[model samples]
Target chain A: MISYLLRRGSRVVRIILFISFCNAVLAEVEIYGEASYENRYFVEEGLFGQDKSHSSFTLSPEFYFESEDQKTSFTFKPKIRRDSVDNERNLFDIQDFSLVKVQDSYETRIGIRRDFWGVTETVHRVDIINQTDQVESFDGEDKLGQPMINLSLEREWGTLDLYVLIGFRERTFAGEKGRLRLPFPIDRNSAQYESSAENLRTDFAIRWSQYYQDLELALSHFSGTSREPEFKAALKNNTNLIIPYYEVIDQTGLEVLYIVGGLAFKLEAISRSGQGDRFSAATAGFEYTQVGILSSSLDLGWLFEFNHDDRYKDSPIALGARLTFNDLYDSQILSGVIRNEETGETNVFVEASRRVRNCCRLSFESVYFNEGTNSNSVQKTFEYLKQDDFARFEFIYYLGN
Target chain B: MRKLFKHFLFVSLFIFLNFTNADDFDRGLEIALATDKNFSGFGDSQTNLKMLLKNRKGFVTERKMKMKLLEVPNDGDKSLIVFDSPRDVRGVAVLSYAHKVGSDEQWLYLPALKRVKRVASKNRTGPFLGSEFSLEDLSFQEIEKYTYKYLRDEDLEGKGCYVIKRIPLDPYSGYTKQIVWIDKTDSVILQIHHYDRKSFHLKTQIFKGYKKYLNKFWRPNEIHMINHQTNKTTTLFFEEMTFNTGLSEKDFTQNSLKRSK
Candidate 1:
């Protein structure tokens, strides 16, 4: 199965390279990327008999080409990760392969691409264009490339972006041997879809964004197969496995950011239909920064956010701080805590990183989950992670220019 | 009768001193306006820059970037800086819209996340790219951002210059005042001595290798800044500075920041 996936991945790369080769005759090409080694140590062993520690290596390289006039450009990026313990944790992806053409007042991009939306730091409720690469990180900040044809129009009123998405990418999950896996293994091949076309369903999205003096706002709507899935327990090979069901969804999202002085107020709200009910969710917050704090070249930023979901009984509040040492090494640290309102469960995470020499970087991250006394649904969903606290260290060596 | 005579004498002296100060202020403003006008009407410019940052211990690191600037008719210039080196920050760009009267606007583009984030421009005192130059030091010096006073006339590097002291009007400025030397020949700034907020001599920036472009614009090919307090230095070397690049407003917009290579 892995070999088949690798073969399919290579085919996509070949097609991209052939098209780029034809364009390279008259274009200037630039190549750059990084190779990183990461190690993760779990404070406690997994309840499913996982290893105490795991290591991995990742490589992601990018090639870019631009015409002499700068009116046309192309980018191709592919990433691969190899895990030391779990096969399911391994990954291979074509993150970006897009060709862009610019005109007087408009631009168009075609092929697989990754686009980001929303502005909040904690949770991104409106950034739903791409599926999450769960095995890479649980924060959902990592995304899989989506095949799309995007058109962007610039007008006096605002900017409008229209997207015609071609296919769907299901979220990757941890296997049984993975540290963050659920109690039962997930059957990767047993995914069911509400749409008859399944992974081939065509999706559509549009976004309009504008900035006025001190405020920036965006409104976006997407109608397609949902990036999120519901799990159903099924008996396969005399063992119970969780099967994923992808449902059709229509979602509308709004993002607003108001900046005044050193404080930034942000909001990301979304209304979605077709899962179990039409539900509304919002994450509202503010980030206040004290630059050059305490007569030193250090900036301390305070983040406060309130997250609400109509489908869940919990309204979690997160508090975080980001410290940037405006030093020679460009050191930074971010730490946050989220407390569940109904269950009293807490989640704490910290990330610190600094540049090493000129070509390398070192980073450390740790995540801890404190259990709640109540047996609420939100707590139950995260109960498995209570003992899966882990600390991770990464060393990245950049290459090329 | 004697006390009244003394009060009148003091009042007259105060009026005379005020009159002399007003003349100095007008002359300072006139010189600043002349310098601003001398560099005007270059429509746009594109330049490549290499920055060498040295620590107190003499360890040097290099950073490469490209700059595009659009001269606004009456307000502050719009500029975009794209980093090309220090591999981790490659493709990261900063877009700035500086105004004459109020605070400047800035945005940062992070290529890793494809995020164009609005940055608080009030942090102008912070170092840029770990270099000796602060964000404020890099921006175009709008005439309205400071109030000036004529200090003296002196010769710098064998060229006659007008020495002036300018106090920053921004409440959050890192420097209390700056002493600037503008060459009399072309009105180009030759050097500046920056004073910290505590009234201590902090840094000195020297502009060298002046070359005339289009016979009207004088640009310095090299800028060297030294921090007196930290004993650190940063030198900027410019290359291929072409003016009138035909860059429009569309090129400096937020969307363009994402596409900036």
Candidate 2:
């Protein structure tokens, strides 16, 4: 069976390469991709009751095509990842596949695409477009492409975007064998949606963004199935089990940022109402940078942010906090620093694993879960991560960036 | 005989009046403004380039990037620079909205994070991509950004050129002053001498091997900048270039930076 699976994987690779070659030869297309290996070492033996060490390799390729006049363009990107310790944790995703046509001040796009809509880094409370590709990383920076018909109009005042999301994709979770995953495997096949149409439910969103001098502001509203799913208890084979439940939700978001001198202040806030009741969340932060320090061409920067959320879930009090599945850790703060070297285009940064480089980069990062919070909801929700405050060392090698 | 005297008087007066008028607007400022005015009207441009960085020991490294620019009327232009080569930074892009006043607005897109980072303009003088070119050097240099003083006129390889000294108005500027040479015939910049804060000659940038595009814009084939203190050099070679691409304000924006290929 293993050999057969390997053969299938190779065949899939060959087919993709063939298609990529044809695209290169047939049209005005440019290819970009990266292959990297990440070796992560958890400080404890089993943070998620799994392994102490984990390693994964990913190969991502993107094909970008444009007309000679650049009036029309398209981009298709696909990624595949394989974990050394768990075949079940291997994953593949069509990160972005979109065709866009630009007409004067308006542009229209149709297909699967990703959109980001927040300013704060510690927590992204307002960026809610595509479902999180959780299996990709813990930071949730990676996202799955969303199917939509999008229209964006640009004016001197601001940019307005309208989206018709045609289909919903369930979020991916790390397999049970993965260390950074939840305690139990999230059964994607048995997922349920509150909408009768389920995954076929149509959704809509609108956003307006503008920038004036040092300030950036964006506001958006989305009515759709919440990307975050709550678990519903059931009896499977006479044993208690839980399946993911997607709730229809309406969310309004706001983001603001200002830059002055070497300092930047940012904010992201979201208010949502749906199956789980109405709640609000916010994250605010500031980043200050010192340039060319000590007469050298090096930049040193510091970042600090506060994250907050009201754990107001209406999934019924009987279900309790363990299965409510709300993102309410009450309040927490994050702090870190970054160092950039201009001589070699190298950046050595700590705090956010958003840190990536060409040759190689090593990082040590830690985030406190703040388990001893005073709120009742916070205490119950963070019970699982009581001992989760631990440091991690990640070393990545760029096979081809 | 009376008609001849009248004609001579008119001719000499015309010469004297023209000379005074020429000196009316600070000779240095006129030349500086002329240099910028002569190169205007490139509505927008798309350029594929290769940057070669050489260390003092003669070892060389290279990076490939594409630049897209849009000219804004009555304001500075907007530019988006996306790196394509060196594998690691393939999808990295930087968008800059240069202005006639104050610092420019810039954002950087990191493919790994799939996010755009707002970059402060305070570090504009830092080296770009580990090369001799500073991010500020790549921006559209407006006449209002500096104070110019006319120096003298000299011949550079049989070409008569006007020399001028300019001090940056922006406090973040790394240089104390820059001596510039502009070709008298075409008003194109020939060379520049950059001075450090301690009054030391730091670097020299020579623009050579020009090619005229559309019979109006004088595009340099190669820009060579050498660092005197470090004995290092960086050269930029334009490979594929197109101008007046009909790209409007839409293509040079914060959203476009993330979508840029």
For each candidate, what's the DockQ? 0.68, 0.21
Model 2 alpha-carbon drift over 4 Å, by segment: A1-28, A47-49, A86-88, A238-240, A312-401, B1-25, B111-114, B154-159, B197-200
Interface root mean square deviation for model 1, in Å? Answer: 1.2
Is model 1 an incorrect, acceptable, medium or high docking prediction? Answer: medium
Compose the digit string of candidate 2's lDDT tens values, residues B153-250. Answer: 89998899999899988887778999999999888899999987777998899998888888888888889999887788999999788987878777
Worst 10 residues of 2 chain A by lDDT: A318-327
Question: Clashing pairs in model 1?
Answer: none
A168-271: candidate 2 lDDT, tens digit per residue: 98888766666555555667778999999999999999999998888889999999999989987766777555678999999999998999887888888889
Q: What does candidate 1's lDDT look like per residue over A167-208, in tens digits?
A: 999889988889888889987778999999999999999999
Which candidate leads in lDDT?
1
* lDDT at B68, model 2: 87
Output the TM-score of candidate 1. Answer: 0.94
lDDT for A73 (candidate 2): 89
